[model samples]
Target chain A: MSQEKSLLNKLVFSLQCLPGVGRKSAQRMAYHLLDKDREGALRLANDLKSAMDEIGNCERCRDYTEASLCEICRNEKRNEQTLCVVESPADVAAIESTGSYTGKYFVLMGNLSPLDGIGPDEIGLNQLKTLVEQTDCQEIIVATSATVEGEATAHFISTIVQGVKDKQVSVSRLAQGVPIGGELEYLDSSTLALSLANRQSI
Target chain B: MSQEKSLLNKLVFSLQCLPGVGRKSAQRMAYHLLDKDREGALRLANDLKSAMDEIGNCERCRDYTEASLCEICRNEKRNEQTLCVVESPADVAAIESTGSYTGKYFVLMGNLSPLDGIGPDEIGLNQLKTLVEQTDCQEIIVATSATVEGEATAHFISTIVQGVKDKQVSVSRLAQGVPIGGELEYLDSSTLALSLANRQSI
Candidate 1:
């Protein structure tokens, strides 16, 4: 009985590791799985085990994949000359879903936060530089988030990639402006300011 | 590579089985597990598998346990004469946390929802009847939610328990009113009306 209680406790405790899951959410998840969806819970367990054990960072772009190079990095049809740099694999998926960009990606996996000891090296800036120097990558599009760390990471990447000796790689950032469908009144002051300052004439 | 991608996809899909987790949240959780917390993910997987495989409903109260009787049911110190009937194991936990309730519990697993084909039998009302008849239980506290189905279930339980021949068992319900720390302006009319109608003398 005590053993069973511990197992239940452990399940709830382990579920808290997921992003945004607190103790209450964890308990709910555990109870929900046990009570309603044991089959799905089992499948989730198997998938989690296999994914965690097998999936590794892509050698080239640092995106998650079992292979040395991710599918994007290995694809021949993608624009190898244009590399979009972002913080994480979720960002990679977000961009891929747009179906517009045909370029490859360099996933930093995290942005620079020096207070948390996340330096340029920590975010694979060295590998990104190496990729730029070794490949025919002509343009680097900085797609980091608009946050302070994201902006800093983008600036650092631009400096490092441009500093690559004898390389003519052009560096650009994703435009910061009012989001599409955003009401002027509801938009934050900083976003509104950026939109006004970087206004483009039709 | 395709196999790995499928595994990742499966993980994300399985994570959606969790309550309140949608496609976006599931994807985020999968990426988070794969990227930031592999060790935690592995532990969660193991714990999930074990919990799902081993945890079974308590035979007496229908609460989750690997044992035939849950810890609460097996405890000798609890007042067996008074059974607090609740809709789910979560409710049992909630009441237990209050530290006021010292009686045993009868977990209904679900309330009476006739529209969804959930009748008394579906919620183990027959089992509850048998429990009340066989045990030395004197009071059955209906601690189901304040929803329509919960009220109907409470009414049904009260009628059935009262109908039992040769034995007398009192049935009661948790009071409904304005919640503690609730303000008059923010509270709904029904709640305010209930608080007013059930007003106690100071």
Candidate 2:
């Protein structure tokens, strides 16, 4: 009985490792799994173990994959000449869901945060530079987020890619302005200002 | 690559079986686990598997346990003459946290919801009746929730226990009124009325 209680407590404690899960939620989740969805909990355990053990970073784009190349990198019809750089594999998924960008991606895994000691080399920027120099890539789309660190990383990448001696690479960034469907009264001042400054003629 | 993606997808899908987790949260959990906390994730997997496989209901109380009897049931210090009947193990925990209940518990696992096909027998009321008849228990405390189903279950248990012949068992319920620290103005009409009707002398 003591061992069983300890195991239950351990399960609850370990469940808190997930992002956004707290002690209360973890206890609720543990009891829920034990009571209602034991099968799903077991399946989740197996999947978590296997995913953690097998999934590795993609050799080319540094995105998560089991193989040397991710599915997008291996696709033949994708525009290899254009590389859209983003902060993480989640960004890759977000862009893929849009179905608008047909180009390849470069996942940095994180942005440049020098205070936290995350620099160019830490985010695999060297691998990105090598990929750009070795391939026939023509355009680099800086698709990092609009946060301060994201902008800094994008600027750094643009400078490095444009510094390539033998090839000319055009660098651009995703547009920053008020989001579609955002009301003018509710939008933040900076976003509204950016939208006004870069207003389109449409 | 396909197999790995399927595994990752399975992880995300299985995570959604948790209460309050949706597709977006599941995706975030999966990515966060794979990226930041592989050790914690693996430990969680092991804990989840073992907890699911080994944990079973306590034979006496019908509460979750690994052995035939739970810790509370095995303890000799508790008041065997008083048994607290609750709807779930969570209720037991809540009451135990108060440190006021020293009696053994009878977990119904669920309430009597006849429309959902859950009757007295479904909630182990027969076991509770047997326990009362065969033991020297003098009091039965119904600690079910304050909801409609909880009240119905409590009433059903009280009626069934009162019908038991050759034994005198005093049945009681947890008080219903204004919660501790609750303001009268903010409380609902029914709660305020209950508090007024059950007013105690200071």
Candidate 3:
């Protein structure tokens, strides 16, 4: 509503760069920063800058880290031979929060999109190749999403790992089906089919 | 997963300060910033810092501004004598977007919440009273939200204005009823009652 090129406008516009934030939310955020939590806003700004300046792709797994290798990659306790490959660093965090997997991760940064011109080389797949070869990994868990692009990426990686002439490394994808506690009636046919095809014994 | 004091962790924690952002969303935002739109994230950080450093309460209306007086208050074309009293700067933005009112605004910054110890002084109600008296405003449109605290604040302001012995100032609240395109069945009973009570003939 304000036609002027004020700092408030700039703040609102900048806030909209966040994934889901729209104009109204951006305005609310701007007002919130000015009104109640200036200290928090300033901290967020400082943190953003610091993170931008310091955080970069981990040399081993492509996860965001200040150091050359991420903590996961550097930890001696983690099973280096069992790498869980994920589409993004957020996926790595998601998998970590489960507290189940003790293996390290390889973040692809994004799934392969052919139409979008993103291929193996574009998203550090060559680096991933070098990583697979250099390390004596026994298994590669494909934790990419269940979407078409995610499946394509997983399949491509699976083919590459299978073709490794010198060594054999088993590749597996995350289970696909209806979610836990989900009703069969509400689930789509594709999920139901996947669930049926990959049915487990009780 | 990387329990160290990493920049990604710092970024995620800082992002959680934004409204409606939880751990997952914060993580996602952190990853998004690092993965795709580093430039945009940096811009947002810069904007946040600059806006925080420059923008402060307007001298007249308590709305955010780079200058002493906000643009609306500074505009000679706007009717200063007709004031729109609202709960926050966001409310001011909402009203301004309507383009119906040519009046100035007085932002309360917050509604009166006696339970939380937010009183007249906390919301700058005394300042509002002084502004009303000094400006000799003909009308005050209480455009606060349709909530208990908003109504209480509106009522408090209405009483103060009516009791002013020096000059006659009219105080009015925004109409509460069904929205313009809302269906009758879906309308809340309180709103329906209000609409029926305030019904007018075409």
Candidate 1: lDDT of A53?
85
Give candidate 1's error at residue A200 in angstroms. 3.7
For each candidate, what TM-score against the reference? 0.91, 0.97, 0.91
List model 3 lDDT by residue over A111-146, tens digit each. 899888988987788887788898989999999988
- Candidate 1 lDDT over residue span B1-202, tens digit each: 2344777888889999999999989998998778779999999999999889888889999988878888898889999999999999888888988999889999999988899999999999999999999999999999988988889999999999999889989888998888888889999999889889999999
For each model in turn, which proportion of the native inter-chain contacts is also found?
0.78, 0.71, 0.69
lDDT tens digits, residue span B37-141, model 3: 889999999999998888888888888888888889889999977999998887787788788999999998888998999999988888888888788699999
Residue pairs with backbone atoms closer than 3 Å in model 3 (clashes): none
* Regions of model 3 farther than 4 Å from truth: A3-5, A175-179, A199-202
Please list all clashing residue pairs in model 2, or write none if there are none. none
Model 2 C-alpha lDDT per residue in residues B53-127, reported as the tens digit of each score: 988999899988878899999989999999999988888878888898889999999989989999888899999
* TM-score of only chain B in every candidate structure: 0.95, 0.97, 0.95
